[model samples]
Target: MMRKIENALAVALIAIVAVLPLFLKFMQGVCRVQVPGADIAVLHFVFLFASVAGLVTWREDRHLSLASLSSVFGEKIRRPIESVKTGGASCILSALFINAFCQLVNPAQFDARFWGMSVRFFFASLPLCYFGIIAMISCKKGNLIASLIGMVFGLFISMGPFTGILYYLFGMENVPSLYAINDAWLSFSKIALLPIIVIFSSLAFFGMPLFLVLGGIAYVLFSAGGGYVDVIPLETYRILTDRNIAAIPLFTIAGYILSQSSAGSRYVAVFKSLIGPFRGGTVIAAVIVSTFFSTFTGVSGITILALGPLLAVVLTGSGYSKDRAESLVTASGAIGLLFPPSAAIIMYATVNYFSIDVFDLFKGAIIPGCIMALSMMATGVVLDKRGERPKFSGKEARDAVLHCIPELLMPAFISVLYFKGVFDLFEAAAFAVIYAFCLSVFVRRDFTLKKSARVVASSVPVSGGVLFILGAASGISYFMLDANVPAILSGFITQYVKNPYVFLILMNLVLLVVGCLMDMFSAILIVSPLLLPLAESFGVSAVRAAVIFLMNLSIGFLTPPVGMDLFISSYTFDKPLSRVVKGILPFLIVQFAVLMLVTYVPFFTEAFL
Candidate 1:
C-alpha cells in the first residue's frame, strides 16, 4: 500500500511539473497580468513557503526535552526566561526603530533595502536544506519526513533570487577578499550536501534513483529563463582545441585495448614462470607484472583483474596459502595507480592548467613506483617465507620468456614513442590503438572484430564516467568562483604560512584529506584552481605542483571509506573491503611518504625538465 502510494505521488508530481509551463502561460494570457517576472516570483514564493513550513514541522516533531535545557538554565530558570524574553523583545524593538528611522530618512532607500529580504532569505535557506538532509540520514526519527523537509529547503535555496545575490556578491571587483565567505558557503553546499547524498544513497538503496530524479529537476529549474549568465569568459582556442582533451579518451582506449589483448595475459604468465621457483615467488611475480602493466595501462582495476587469476594459480601451485595470495594480489594492484600513463595523471595535468609530458611524468614516476613495488615485495617476502619454493626447469624458463616477449614489447613501444616525441600524447595514443589492433589481428591472431568492438564499447562507460564527473565539477567550480572562494582562501593562507615549505605542507595535508573522500579526478579539478595560485606565490613550478597534487590524490584510491580502487580490489580478491584495506596498508604508507618527498623535493620532478 505504501509502495503504491509512493509511486502514485511520484507520477503525479512528474505530470504536474511537465504541464506547469503551459498552465502558467494560459493563466497569464487570460488574466492579462502585467507582471513581468510573475512565473519566477510565484515559483520562488511557493518553494520558500514550503521550505519554512516543512522545517518548522520537522523541528517541532523532533523537539528536545525540557530537561535538556537545564544546562542553559543552571538551576536559574527565572534568569534564563528573563534573558530569552529580554533578548527577543530587544531584537523586535530594534527592528521597528531601524525601520522607522529608514522611513523618515528616505522612503525610497528603505523600500530598496527591504526588497533585499528575498536575497537574504535565499542565502539563509541553503544551510537549512543541508542540515535537514543530514538530520534525515543521521537522526533516528521519521527519515521520510526529514527528507521531505530537506527537499523543500533545497528547492527554496536554489531559487532565482538567491542565485542572483550569489552572482552579485561573487561578481564584485576585489571579491577575492571574501574568500572565507565563499569557502564557508561552498563547504555547506557542495562538501556537506555531497556526503549526505552519498550516505543516503548507500543506506536507502532506493535513495539513489530518487536523488537522480531530484537532481535532474533541480538542474532544469536552475537553468530556466536564463538570459546568458556569463559567469566565466570562455577561452577561445583553449575550449575549441579538442587536442587538449584528445589524449584523455585515446589513452583510456589504449589502456582498455591492451587489457583485452593477449599481451596482458602473457605479461602475467611470464612473471609467474620467471619467479615461480622461489618462496613468495608468485607474490613477487604479481608485483613485477603489476609494475610492467602500469607502464602501458596505468589502471589499477585492469592490472588486478589481469594478474589476479594467474597469481592465484601460481601461488596455490607453489604451495602458498590463500590468505597470502590475496594479500599479494591486493597490494600489487595498487601500484598501477601511482605509475605512468595513469588517467589520474592526465586529469591532474589538465586541471592544473599545465601539460605533463607523458614521458617525463612516466620517468619521474619510476623511482616512486619502484619504491612502492619494492615495499610490497619486501612485505611478501616476509609474509610468505615459510612456504615451499617451486623450481622450474631451464626449458620452462625459456618458454616463459618466449611467451612473454610479444606482450613485453608493447610497453617498450610506448616508451620509445615517449622519448622520440613522435606523438605528443594524442598521436601516441592513436598509434598505440592501431598497433594493438594490428598486433591482435595479424601477429597474435587473438583479437577478432567482434572482440575488438566489444572492448571498444566497454571503454565508453569508463571514459564517460570520468568525463561526466569532470563536467559536474565544472559546474561546481563555476559556483565557487561566483562566491569568491579562491580569493578568500588565498588571504587566509598568506596570513599564516608565509614560508613556501610550510605552505606546501599545508596544501599536502589538505589534498591528502580531500583525496580520502573524493575520487582523484574530481579532487584535482575542484582543488587545483584554488591551490595553484598559492603554489605560484611560493615560487613553486606549476608542473611540479600538479604532479604532487595528482600523486597525493591517487592515494585516495587505496584509502578506506570512499576508495574506488580498494572496492575493485576487494571484488577481485572476493575478500571483504576491510581485509583488502588491511592488505594495502603498507603500500599506502609507502606511497604517501613518497608523495611528501615529491612535494618538497622539486628536484625529483625537475631532473627531466
Candidate 2:
C-alpha cells in the first residue's frame, strides 16, 4: 500500500518538474498569462508554489496544536487541534492564487503603494498559508471557523489600525524621524519578539517540518523588524531556481538509477575481487560503493535508502551479525560528504555569502575524505576478526572488472569534463543522466525504456523534497543576515574564546547540535556564516575552515538524538531508533576519532589545496 502511494507521488513530481523547462520560458517573459495590474506574471511561480505545497503535505502529517500558541507545549500540545489532508493545502493555495490574481487584476483603489503592498502581501502570506490552509481544511467545522477568525486577526494586524490611531492621538505625523511616528507599534513588536520566538520555536519542537519552521520564524522576525514582506517569496524563488543547483536533482536521479540497478552489486563484486581474500572484503566493498553514490548524490540518506539493504545482506551472509552489518552500513552512509562534488559542499560555497571557489574547496576535501573512508575500513577489519577469506580467482576478478567498467569510470568522466571546462556542473549533471541512462538501459540491460521511467519516478521525489527545503531555507538565511545576527554572534564568540583549539571544539559541538536539529544542507546555510569569521581570527585558511565546518556537519548526520542519517538507517533496516542508536555507537566513536584528527591535522586538508 505504501509503495503504491509512493509510486503515485513520484509520477506526480516528475510531471511537475517536467513542466519546469517549458514553463520557465514564461518566467523569462517569452510567455505569460497577462492579468491586469501586474506586468510580470510568472507562471513558473505558480508551478513552484504548487510543487512546494504538495511536497510539504505529502511528506508530513497534516496536524497542529492549539496549545502550541500558548506557553504550554510539551505534552499538552500532543493532542492535535485537527488533522488535515491534501485538500486542505489545495484550499489554501486556491485562496492564495485567487487572492493574488484578484490583486493583480485590480488592486483596491489602485494606489501604487497599495498595489505593491497587495502583491507583497500575497507573497508574504505563502509560508503562513501552509498552516492557515491546513487549519481551514480540517474535517471539524470548528477548525474552519477558527482558521477564518485567525485570518481576520492577521489582516487587522497587517493594516496597523492601532498604529494609525496612536499616531493620530500623538499628532506625530510631522516628526523628523519617521520611526518616531509609529513609536508605540515598533516598541511593542520588539518587546513581544521573545514570546513570538518561543511560540514559533515550539512549532519546530513539535516537528512542524524544518523548512516551514525556518521560513515561519523568518517571516515573524522580518515582520517585527519592519522588513519588506516580499523578501520571503523572492528569496524562495531565487535560491530554488538557481541554474547551478539543478545539478543536485540530476545527480540524485543518476545515483538512484545506479542504486536500483545491477550497478551497486557490480561495484561490490569489483571491490571484492580487488580486495581478494581479505578478512573484511565485503565491508570494504559496501563502504566504497556507498562512497561513490554519496559523493555524486550528496545526500547520505540516498546511499542508505538505496544500498543499505543489499549491503546489510552481504555483510550478514559473510558471517557478521545483523546488528553489526546494519551498524557498519549506517556509519559509512555519510562519508560521501567528505568527497568532491558534494552537494553539501557546493551548497556551502554557494550560500556562504563569500567568494570561495568551488574547485578550491573540492581540492581541499580529498585527504580528510580518505581519512574518513579508511577509518571505516579499519573499524570493519577490527570488529569482525574471523578470517573467512574468499578464494581469489583471476577469471572471476576479470569478469567483475569487465562488468563494472562503464559505471566505475563515471568520476573520471565527470572530472575531465568539469575540470577541463568542456562542461559546467549542470552540463556534467546532464551528461551523467545521459551516461547513466545508457549504462543501465543498453550496456547493462538493467533497465529498458519502461523500466527507466520507474527509476525516474522513484527518484523525482527525493529531488523535490531536497529542493523545497533549500527554497524555504533561503528566506531564513536572509532574515538572519539582514538583522546582522551573524556579525553579532561572531563578535560574541571572538570576545570570549581566543584559542583556536577551544574555538574548534566549541564549533564542533555547535554544529553537532545543529545537525541533530536540521538537515545538513539547511545547517550549512544558517550556521556556516556565523562560524567562518572565527576561522580568520584563529588564523585558518578558507579551505580548511570550510572542511572543518562541513566535516563536523557530516559527522553530525551520524550524531544521535536527531541525526538525520540515524533515522534513515532505522527506516531502511526496519530497526527501531534505539536499536539503530545502540548499533551505531562504536562506529560513532571511530567517527569522532577521525574527526579529531581532521580537526587538528592541518596537513590533511591543506596538502591537496
Tens-digit lDDT string for candidate 2 (433-457): 7677788999889988888877776
How high is the lDDT of residue 518 in model 2? Answer: 71
Cand. 2 Cα-lDDT: 0.67
RMSD of each: 16.7, 7.7
Per-model TM values vs. the true structure? 0.61, 0.79
Model 1 TM-score? 0.61
Model 1 misplaced stretches (Cα beyond 4 Å): 1-241, 278-280, 294-298, 354-363, 478-484, 498-504
Task: Judge candidate 2 at residue 147 and give its lDDT.
Answer: 53
The window of 10 residues in a row where model 1 has the poorest summed lDDT is 231-240
